[model samples]
Target chain A: MDFTIILQAGIASGTVLLFATLGELFSERAGVLNLGVEGMMLIGAMTAFSTTIATGNPWIGVLAAMLFAGLISQIHAFIVITLQADQVVSGLSLTFLGTGISLVLGEGLSKAGTVSLLPNFSIPLLTLIPIIGKIFFTDQSILVYIGYLLVPLSWYYINHTRPGLHLRAIGEYPSAADALGISVFRQRYFYVFVGGMLAGLAGATISLAVSPGWFSELTTGGQGWIAIGLVIFAQWDPIRAAVGAYAFGALRRLILDIQGPVLLLGFANPFYYNPYLGFFLQMLPYLFTVVVLVIGSREAMRKRIGAPAALGNPYVRGERGK
Target chain B: MKKFLQSEWMSRLIDALLPVFATLAALIIGAVMLLFLGVNPIVAYKALWDGAFGSGNAFAETLVKATPLLLVGLGICISFRGDVINIGGEGQMIIGGILATWIGLTFTGLPGWLAITLALLAGFLGGAIWGGIPGYLKAYFNVNEILSTVMMNAIAVQIMNFMMRGPMLDPIQAAKASKIPQTARLIEAFRLARWSPTRLHLGVLIAVILAILVYILLWRTTLGYRIRAVGMNPLASRYAGIKVPRYIVMSLLLSGAFAGLAGAIQVYGVNYRMITDGSASGFTGNAGFNGIVAALFGQLHPLWSIPASILFGALLVGANQMQRVVQVPSALITALNGLVVVFVVSSEFLRRRRQRQRLAHAKMDDAPPDKTSQPAEASA
Candidate 1:
C-alpha cells in the first residue's frame, strides 16, 4: 500500500464526514438532534455548485452553500420549536424537503462545467515536516484545515464556555434551565441554526474542496447519515467525533483498497469486475455504523457510554415541569 | 341540544376542511416559489393535473400508483397508532419483494393460485421479519426504534443491491450485462390481470379490504385495545398489567407485514419483477413515507387511512400530469408531500392556540362583574 496516498485520501474523506459530524455534535449537544444533516448537505452541495458556476469564486460558492443550508434549517427549527412539532419527523421532513428542492433547483445548473478548485494552503515551516506534514498541511485546501481546527474549537466552546454550559443544561433538562431563566427555545434554535450553517459548510467542502464540481442525486452518498452515526460514536464530543470521522474515512479507503484483492480471491479475473466490488465496498461505513450502534448499546457498552439526556425529545416549556 | 349539535357539526366541518386548507396553503407557497423560478405557476399546475388525472389512462395510472401507497399507508397507520415511527417501510417493502421474487422463482411450476398466494405470504413474512427486528430491539432493550429502523433500511438497500448483483442475478442475463439489477418476471398466470384496458388491477380492491381489516382489528379486538392503550400511555398500560413491550413489538410486526404485502402486490400485480430501486421513484415504497402523511392526515385511524391514502395517491398521480402540462419538475410532488407533513404536524399547535383562546374566553365569562372589573382595571 502507498501509505502517503492512503493517508491523504483518509484525511480528505475524514474532512467531509468531520465537518458534518462536528456540526451535528454541536446541535445534538445543545439537545436537539437534527436528522436533516443529509438534506442540508444536499442543499449545500447544490448551492455551492451553482454559486461557484455563476460567480466563478469557490469561496463565494462556499458561503452561498452555508447560507442556503442554514436557511433550510431555519424551517426545521420553525417546525420543531415554533410549532412544537416532533423534532424527528420535522428533521426528516426537512431532509426530504431539502433534497427535493435542491434537486429541482440544481437540475439546470448540474450541466455546468467545473469551477476552479479551491487552492491549497501550506503553512510555512510546517510543510517541511515528514509524513505528517505531507498528509495534513502540504497541498491541502483551506477548508480541510478549517475542518480539523473546528474539532478543538468546538470542544473548547462546548466544555469551557458559559454558553456551552447553558447549551448542555438546556439539552439535559430544559425545564431546569428554564427555571434558571435560560430561553430554551432560543438556545435550541440558535444551536440548530449554527449546526445547520456548519453542516452547510461541510457540504460545500465536498463540491469545492473535494469533488470541486457539480453532481446529481446521492452525490454525498449517505455521508450525512454516517455523520449522524459518528456523533453517537463520538459520544457527543467534537474532538472524538473528528477521530471517529477519520477512522470511518480510513475504513472506507481500506475497503476500496482491498476490493480488488478480495474480489480476485473470491472470483478469478477480479480486475474485470473491480468497479462492482468497489460499489459494494462503499457501503462499508453504513454497515459498520449499524454494527457499532448495536454493539455500543449492549449492556456492557451502555454502562460506559451515554447519549445526550434530552436527545430527540421535544421541549415544551410548561410541559417539561410536568 | 340544538346548540350542541350546531357546534359538533361545525367542529366536524373544520376537521374535514383543515387538511384541504393546509394543502392549499402549501401549494400557494410552492407556486410563489415557482414564480420566483420564472415558471408560470398556473400553467405548471394545469400540466400536473392533466398528466396525473386528465384521461382514463391517467386515472388508471393514478390508481395503479396508489395501490402500493394505500397498503403502505395502512401499514404506517398501524405503527404510528402504537407511537412507533417505522420509517423503514421502504426497506421492508424491498425485502418483501426480494422474498416474493425468491419464492416465485423457486416454485415456478406450482398452480397459479397457489403460487400467487405463496408469493404474497413470503412478502408479508419478509417485511414482518425486517420490521420486527427493530421492534424487538426497542421492546427488549429500549433501543431507539427510529435509529434502528433507519439503519435497517440502509442495510436492506445494500443487501438488495448485493443480491441482485450476485446471488439473485437472472441466469439468462450474462454476468457482464450492465442492465439494471432485477429479478425474473413472475409467471403470467400468477400476475394480477387488469380489469380492463386501464392499468388498475386487483391490488386496489385488496388494499381497500386490508384497510377495512385494519380498522376492525384496531377498533374491535383485545389486541387492538392493548395496542391503543400502550400507544396512549406506555406507563399506564404497564401499570394496568398490559404487556407493553409485547404490544409494541406486535404493532411494528403487523405494520411490517402490511408493508411487505404491498411490495409483493407491486411485484406480482404491477412491475412483475423486482427492480433495484424499490419505489423511491413513486413505484414502490415512496408510498411507505407517503403512508406517514396518510396516517397523520387520517388522524392515525385505519378507517381514515383509506381516503387519506387515496387523496395522496391522487396528489402523486396529479403531480405527474401537472409536470407534463406545466413543464415543472415532478420532484415538486415530493415537496408537496413534505409540506403536507409539516402542515399536519404543525396544525396541533394551531389547535392548542385555539383551545387556549377558548379557555381564556370561558374564564372571562365566569368572572363575577365586580371582580372582573377590578382585574380589568388593574390590567388597564
Candidate 2:
C-alpha cells in the first residue's frame, strides 16, 4: 500500500466522522442525545445523491442534504423535547424511519444514474510535499477543508464563547440553566437540529464525495455509531474526537489497502486460502470499536469529566433534580 | 357516555385499546404514503389483509413470518424488563443459527428429537454468550449496551458471511463453484415435521409455548420480580438486597437465549438451510430489530407481543400479496413499521401520563364526603 495514498483516503473518510462527531458533541453539550445520526446521514446521502444527479452540482447537493436532514431532526427534537419521549427510543425510531425512507428513495435515484463526484483541488506548495502534505493538506475534497475549519471552530465555540457556557450548564443541570434564564428547551432544540444537519452533510460527504453514490443503509456501515463512540472516546471534545475519527478511518482503510498484496503473496499462510478471510478483516472496525469502548471507559465511566451529566434526560420546566 | 367515561373499567379498556389505536394510526400513515405514490389506500390495505389472513395458505405463511418475530419479540421484552436493551438480537440470532446448523450437520448419529434438542441448545448457548457480552459490559464497566450491541450487529454480519462462504459452505456447491452462500440441507431425519399443504411447522407451537413461559417467568416467578425491580429502580433494588448487576446480566442471557432459539427454529423449521437472501438486511431478515418494534407495540408485555408479532407478520406476508396486486414494494413494510414504532414509542409516554392523570382523578373522586356535601349545602 502507498502510505501517502492511504493517509489521503483515511483523512478524507475521517472528515465524514468529523462532521457527525462535532454535531453529536454540540447536541450532547445541550443535553440531547440524538441517536439518529445514522438515519439522518442516510437521509442526507439519499437527498444529496438525487439532488446532485438532477442539478449536476455537488454544492447544491450538500445544501439540500443538510436542509432535509435538519428538517428530519426536528421530528426528533419535538419527540424528545416537546413530547418528552424517551430519547433513545425516539432516536432509534428516527434511524429506522430514515434508513427505510432513504432506501426506498435511493432505489429511484440510483436508477437516475451516478452523478459527478465532488471535485477535489490541491494546494500548490502543499501538494509538492513528499508525504506529509499529501496526507493532510493536499488532494482532499472541499468538504475536508471545511471539516478542517470546523474542528477548531467547534472547540472555540464550546469553550470560549458565552452560549457555549450556557450549553454546558444545560447539559450538566438543566434546572440550573433554566434558573439562569437559559431556555433549556430552545437551546437543545437548536443544537439537536444543527447536529442533524451536520450528520446530513456528512452523509453527502459519503454519496457526493467519499464513495460517490447511494447505497442501501450505506451510512450504517459503522460511521454514525463510530461518531457517537468518538463523542465518548473524545470525552465530548471536538479535537480529541477528530483524532479518534482519523485513527478509526485509517484503520478502516488499512485492511482494504493491504488485503490485495497479502492475498497475492500468501503472507497470511493457511488463512490466505480462505475466501472468508476478507470478512474477518471486515470485522476489525467494529471489533476495534468494542475494544476502544471497553478500555476507554474501563475506570471512570460516568464520573469522567466532560460527560454531560444530564446528557440523555429530557429537560422539563421546574422539575426537581431531573 | 359520561357514566361510561367515569367507570373504572374504562381506564382498563383504554389501556388495552391504546396499542390498537397506535397500530391503526401507523397503518393510516402508511396508507397516506401509498397515496402519494399513486396507489389507492383502500385497495392496498384490503390486499394486505387478504394476503395475510384471507386464506389458509396465507395464514400458514404468516405463521412462518410470525414465528421468529414472536420469539425475538418476547426476548426483547425479557431484557427490557431488566432495564437492559438487547439490540444484539440480530447478531445473536445469526450466531445461534450458525451453531445450530453446525450441530445438526455434525451430530447426525443421535436420534431425531435428541439431535434437534442438542442443536437448539447449542444455538441458545451461542446467542447467550453473544448477548451476555453487552450485559456483562454494562454491569461491570457501564459500557453503553446500545453502542456495543449495534456495533456487534456489524461484526455478526461479517461472521455470518465468513461461515457461509468458507467453512460451512456446502461441499457439493463448493465443487460446483457456486457462489450462493448457504449450508448443505439438513439431514432428513433432523427436518421439522410440517403440517401438510400449509408450510406451518412445529416451531409455531414452540414460539407460542415460549411466549407463555416468558409471561409466567416475568410475572409469576421470583426471578421476574427481581428483574422488574431492577428495571424499575436499580437503587431501590440495591437497597432491597437485590444484586442489580446480576439480574441485568441474567436478563440479557435469557433474552439472548430466546432469540437464539428463534434462529435455531428458523433453520430447523422454516428455511431448513442457513443462507442470506441478498437483501440489504442481515441474515435475520430484520427480525432482531423488528422484534423490538413488535415488543414496543405490544407495550412490552410477553402476551401482548403475540398479537403484535402476528400483526407485523401479517404485514410482511401480506405485503408480498399487496406487491403482487398493487405493485407497492414490500420494502415499504419497513418504513411503515418504522412509523408504527415512532408512534408506539411516543404513545407509551402518553399512556403513562394518562395513568398518572387517572390516579389524580381517583384521589379527587375519593375526597372527603363532608367537603363534597359542603358545596351543595352552600349552594342551597
Candidate 3:
C-alpha cells in the first residue's frame, strides 16, 4: 500500500483519460459534440491489439488504431456535418456501430497471448527531483511521456495559434467564421476527425501501453463517458482537463487497491471481508463523474462561463441565427 | 419522367418508403460483412428468416422478445418527442426491476392481481426517480442529460450487481458452491399470466395497449401537445407559458416509467425471477438500446413502434438461430442496428431537401416574384 506506487500507476492510467478528454474537448470546441468516444475507443483498442498481434509492432498498432477510429468517426462527421442530422443520436449510433464492429472483429483476440509493448523509460535528470520525479518522470510508457508534452502543447495551440482562433470562431460563431472565408463544414469535419484520432490514441494507450490487453467492452469500461464528463468539468480547457484526468485516475487506482488489504487504518477492511462490498467501491468513478458534473454546472452558473455558443447545432450556410 | 418523379404523390411515396430503403441498405452492408466472415450471406439470411418466422412457437417467442422492446420504445417516444434524450433506460430498467422484485418477494400472500399491480407501480416509481434526477439537472442546472444519464447507467449497474450478489441472492443458491446471482423465484401466483403451450404472456397485451395510450397522450392530449411543442421549440413554448422545464422533467419521468414497466414485465412474465450475468446487457438483453432503434424506425410514433419492435425482436430472436446455423456471431445484429440508425437519420436530410424543393417549386408557380426560391437550391 505504498502511496507512491499508487500515484505512479495512476499517472499511467490517467494518460488514457487525458487522450480521450482532450479529443472530446477538440470536437466540442469545434461545435460538433461527438458522443461516440466510447465506441471509437473500443475500435482503437481492438485495432491496436489485433494489429500488434499480426504485425509484431506496437507502434504500427497505435497508428492503425488511430486511423481506424478516425475513419469510423467520418460516419458521424458526415451525418452531423454534411447531412445535418442530430449529433446526439448520430453519435450514439456510432458508439453502437463501433462497439459491435470491434466485438465481431476482436472476437477471439483476447486469447492472443502477448505482443511487444510501447517503450518505457525514465528521464535522466528529472528522475532525481524526489517525489515529483519518481511519480512523473520514473520509468513510464512513451505514450505517458507524450501525454506530458500534449497537455501544454494543446493548451498553447488552442489559445495562441491562428488556426486555434479559427477553430474557436467556427465553434462559437460558425456563420461569422464562414463569412470570413473559413469553411465551417470543412473545419468541423477536421476537428471531429482529430477528436476521433485522439480517442483512438487513448484506446491504443490502454491495450498497448497502460493495461496492455483487451477484455471487450470492459477494456475502456465507462472511461469514455467519464472523459465526456471531464470535458464539462474542465470547462473545455486542456490544463483543467489534465488535472481532472489525473485525479480521476488516482481515484480509480485507489478503489482497485483498497480491496486488497485485510486491514485499514488500524481496523479490519470491510471490502476485504465482504467482496460484494467492493461493487460499491467500483462505482466511485461513475458516481464521482455525476458529482463533478453537478459542481461544473453550478460553477459555470456562478461564473457565467459555458460551452461553445454553437455547440450541438448543425451549421448550415445561410441559415438564420446560426 | 422528371415531372412524374416531382409529383406530390411520388414525394409522399418516397417519404413513406425511406425507412425501408435505409433498412435495405443496412442489410446489404450486413451481407457484405457476412461475406468477409467467410459465410454465405444468402444461406445465413435464409436461416435467419426461417428462424424468425419458421414456426408458430418461434413467432410466439418473437412476440415475447418484442414485449420489452415495445415497452422501452414507448418511453423513448415520450422522451425524444420532448427533446430530452433519455439514455438512462438501462439504469432505469434495473432500478425498476429491483423495486418490482422486492415487492413480489415480500408480498407473497397478497392477492395476485393486487400484488402484480403494486409491483408494476413500484417499478414505475423507481424509474421515474432515476430519470427525473437527470431531467431536473438538465432543466435547472443546465447539466447535459446525455452525460449524466450515461453515468447513471454505470451507477445503476453497480447497484444491481451489489443487490443481486448480496441482498437479493437466493438463499438456496447462496448455499451452493456456484452462487449464481439471482433472486428467489417470484411467487407463482404473481407471475404474469402465460398462454397455454407458449411463452407469450399478458405482458405483450399490456405493451400493445400502452403504445396506443402513449400515442393518444402525445397527439390527443394537452399534456402531450405541450411536451411536443416544447420539444419543437422550448423558447417559444416558454414564452407561450408552457412551463418548459416541467414538461422536460415530465417527459423523462414518463419515459423512464415505461422502461421500468418493461423491467417488471420481464421479471414477472419472461424469466419469473430477476437474474444477472454481472453486466447490464446480460440482464436487459440490450433491450434498452434496441428500443431506441425501434422508436427511430417507427418515426418516433408509439403506434408505429409496435411493428418496429416486432421487426427488431425478430432480428434478435433469429440472430440466435443464425449463430447456431451459420456460426456467425450474433454481434452482427447490433452492428446492423447501428447502421440502420445512421442511415435513417442521414436520410432525413434527403426528406427535408425534397420538401423544401417542392415548396420552392410551388412558390415559383404561385408567385413568380418570390425572393425565397432563389436561395433554396443554393442552401440545398
Which candidate has the highest TM-score of all?
Answer: 3
lDDT of each: 0.79, 0.85, 0.92
Tens-place lDDT digits, model 1, residues A5-29: 6667778778889989988888887
RMSD values, in order shown: 3.3, 3.1, 2.0
Ranked by lDDT, top first: 3, 2, 1
Candidate 2 residue lDDT tens string, B1-380: 97787577997888788877877888888888888879998999999999999999899999889988999899899898888888888888988998999999888798999889898898889889888888898898877888888888788888888888888888887888566888899988897889988889999998999889999999999999999999999999999999999999999888888888888988999888898753215467888888888888887899899999999999989998998999887777888887887887777777778787778778868986554355544767
Q: How well is each residue in B1-380 modelled by candidate 3, as lDDT tens digits? A: 99999999999999999989998999999999999999999999998888888999889989999988999999999999999999888988899999999999998889999999999999889889888989998888888889898888888888888888899889999999998899999878998898869899999999999999999999999999999999999999999999999999999899888888888888888887888887889778988889988998999999989999998999999999999999988988989999999999999999999999999899868875766456645867
Task: Identify the superior model by lDDT, candidate 2 or candidate 3.
Answer: 3
Better of 1 and 3 by TM-score: 3
lDDT of 2 at B320: 86
True C-alpha contacts between chains kept, each model in order: 0.42, 0.64, 0.81
Highest lDDT model number: 3
Give the winner by DockQ: 1 or 3: 3
Candidate 2 docks at the CAPRI level of: medium
Give residue A273's lDDT in candidate 3 (0 to 100). 48
Q: In candidate 3, what are the lDDT values of residues A1-322, reduced to their tens digit?
A: 6778789889999999999999999999999999899999999999999999999999999999999999999999999999999999999999989998988898888899999999999999999998899999999999999999999999999999999999999999999999999999999999999999999999999999989888998999989989999999999999999999999998998888888788887788877846577888888898899889999989988999889999999998998997
lDDT at B251, model 1: 88
